[model samples]
Target: MGLKPWQKALFPLRSVAAVVRLFEAELRQPEPDLVLLSLVLGFVEHFLAVNRVLPTNVPGLTFESRPGPDPQTRLYFPVAELSIVAALYARFTAQIRGAVDLSLYPRPDGCSSRELVRKVSDVIWNSLSRSYFKDRAHIQSLFSFITGEEGPPRVPPGTKLDSSGVAFAVVGACQVLGLPDVHLALSEDHAWVAFGAGGSQTAEVTWHGKGNEDRRGQPVQAGVAERSWLYLKGSYLRCTRHMEVAFMVCAINPSIDGHTDSLELLQLQQRLLWLLYDMGHLDRYPMALGNLADLEELEPTPGRPDPLTLYHQGIHSARTYYNNEHIYPYLYLAGFHCRNKNVKEALEAWADTATVIQE
Candidate 1:
């Protein structure tokens, strides 16, 4: 990759110029794999921060991971960084491929693709130090999977991947195995993989709640049939690559502490969410619409729809696509209405929410 002449460059960041030039062509492909680059970059940021390689106190002087559930742990995220991404991507890909050879798991099983997914899940699930803390926030990503540093070096061992991370790892591994059909399936609190024909096949690849071992090889429909609120009665996202990227966008944590947010990270998340929204990827993913609506409410984009419109679209998506089975979209809209002092409308929204609950 040739960098433009330095004299012609406003700021001579050769690496940035190289990646920008690379992306210009990559972005034009029928479908660009920006999500891979994004996740890898995110992992690099977290790896740098959590190893105590970067100081946390100063905003600009040093990078710091954002605070998650655990105040003691943080993960940094930088948008343009690419140097570490390539190496990490290769290592992580090889790590999973080495875990489960594709020849042993050629296609989806009758058991909802479990055989293949569990192999991927086990690699991540078993990688953590024995007795690591599972409640840390930022560890629910590939950063933890790749670096094995759930928190700062001083934070001590026992950093297990959160349940979602295992599922994400499985889906990502399948992608690495060249299985584009495999994708992440998400409900309110659980994550799994959807694969096979039309992404109709599904399997549990992560533990849902504590104490019980993971039901790693079971089909998802059991929960739906059992009427578990966790399944939302067939309401869940069988995500495409784009929607999965939106999921990562919604998962962005910008808190430097409980009180402050990284404006740069927040702005990046908002821009990415808006990009996905404009690309029509959020149509079936109501919670994404609600998440983007939350951002729009806080930062009101100049030319986009108002937060109320976004909220309503979320509700509409739930009703139309998920048969009104999803409750969050309604609750999100109701919360917005209540916060805005729309007393009568809020009550109506609440009533509608109750109707969904009754179903």
Candidate 2:
């Protein structure tokens, strides 16, 4: 199989030198779209239907033969073209401004006040013409309006962005509106934004699990006391833009079928995570570290920390960032041990998770 018309349009990299060049540029890149990670993932997924890239029948996480081989491999990480990235950026920036009378929602406290956050949230939330069907599956990407898109056609009306996409959209819109104080807040299974000085205030920018009341723009106070994994026992990450980029990278979906993956996409994800990790972006994002650790467990990266160390680092991230209340980091470690049949270590990890729960 040769390059498809659209993939060719991306100017896909076919050599190792291209990877090195892009990786260096990426470390210094500012705008989210410039890296165009989301676009790259979306681009591969766009061709999946016609790809006939069958699932590898390999047993577990680690694969026997990786997707591509040597220099002539089909797997190439595409740095998104500047024109498309700029067009999407400008579109979202304009939408955020034109969609609302932003002056009416001033940041009263000289930072991201609760009202201003709410107004931004409302703009994204209300845009959901099909609010009732928001949880539909897809991948999310950057742009002022975060969203999930699938298939090769234009997104149909009433197709809402995934939950984090909504939160990212709010934060992104705020950024376009000139408020760097607003940043993404993430629990294990949900996403929102934290704002105000020192991120002292929190608000829901997207819907949570199914059948819950729409809490968009409401403060996340009571849930911390409710004390459930639903809220990570108050364990949340208030992410900087770099950390958010790591999350977006962590969220990349490369699955092709039951036991198959898009090798290029997975490789792209792994390399990008390493890039972010070296830049110290994943320090506060436990789950992203956990995600990288999982990949390393399957395909160990030389000159990098091993899977077990990375897993513990994720827990340590939870410890430092959220006072060790978060449990998913522990759970990730436990799962790893269990999978490797390290029963004793697995039990200890579970115990550590329980200790966090009891706190």
Candidate 3:
């Protein structure tokens, strides 16, 4: 989507020029804030394809792929520079409180470059995770699964840089400094930041090497075969094609086994089956329902509950919780049956749904 007029007004190209000037002037005797800001601006400039720095003479840097459960694009940085950036970012967060006012650029309300970076990180992180996960705890658990850790590290909470954290921080810092062309590409294996206008205008940085030369040709591995459940503030059904959903499940329940069946799982699967039916993906409904059936036959264990019991219990909970709105499930179910030529079943489901809606 195109940037709104207000967003463009908030981040004008002139802001980039101002930061570039600051970066050039402060290259010598660079303050922590200035250095961090400079790096952020530089990346933004590179993303824009502006010839701010000559290619042959650019500073020597080492490129590293971001480590996480999800797929991540590679990041290139000057060796040993991240420590300084991280420390500055931490200091910046200590000074700022509340929302970042980007209009006051170059020195927003006398906030230093360090403060700017922190503010940017806070803004971007909050926006990105708003609907996907609950809080830092969710992020922590997701990070742990990606790293195969028993749990997230016990770091005293404040701004500390890690492999996964720095990318978002950098993106946020760059964004506030007037490079508003950032985009995030999320997939089952990894998530990475991209730059430029989306569609034909979008561009992403990649390391060119022997093995990486054919990166575009690499095939994406399929996720779970069966339909999966996703629970946030509300519950939803997801398909294997839903890479982000699959990634979230694996991250949150890293050790979940046996079809990933649970009360939540069964409900989600049923929901997805109905959705597929409603969306006219008739061929997928049976496949999804079959997944639910498979779950039903699996023996109940301490962790893996009986699918049949969970299915009924889930429907009861949905009806009790949603009451009038509970027709959503039946609506999808009716659609599924109708599409599959089961006229009687469709009518029965629709009747139940209409009763609830009418009441």
| Candidate 2 residue lDDT tens string, 105-138 | 6666678778788888887777665534554334
1-359 per-residue lDDT for model 3 (tens digits): 22223322322223323333333333322122322442333333222222223345534333222333346632222222343334434444432323567555465333234344444444534333112222222232211212221224863233222222333344434533545444323321223334433311211122122232212212112111222111111222222222222222222221123443223223333333333333333231222333343434542334443544433443454555433234444655666567668899889878986775465
The count of backbone overlaps in candidate 3 is 6
Off by over 4 Å in 2: 1-67, 70-79, 129-136, 142-159
Best-fitting candidate, measured by TM-score? 1
Model 1's number of clashes is 5
Judge candidate 2 at residue 313 and give its lDDT: 95
lDDT (0 to 1) per candidate: 0.67, 0.68, 0.34
Return whichever of 1 and 3 wins on lDDT: 1
- Top lDDT model: 2
Model 1 Cα shift for residue 236 (angstroms): 1.8
Q: Clash pairs of candidate 3?
A: 69-146, 70-189, 70-190, 71-189, 71-190, 71-191
TM-scores for all predictions: 0.79, 0.79, 0.24
lDDT: worst 10-residue window of model 2: 58-67
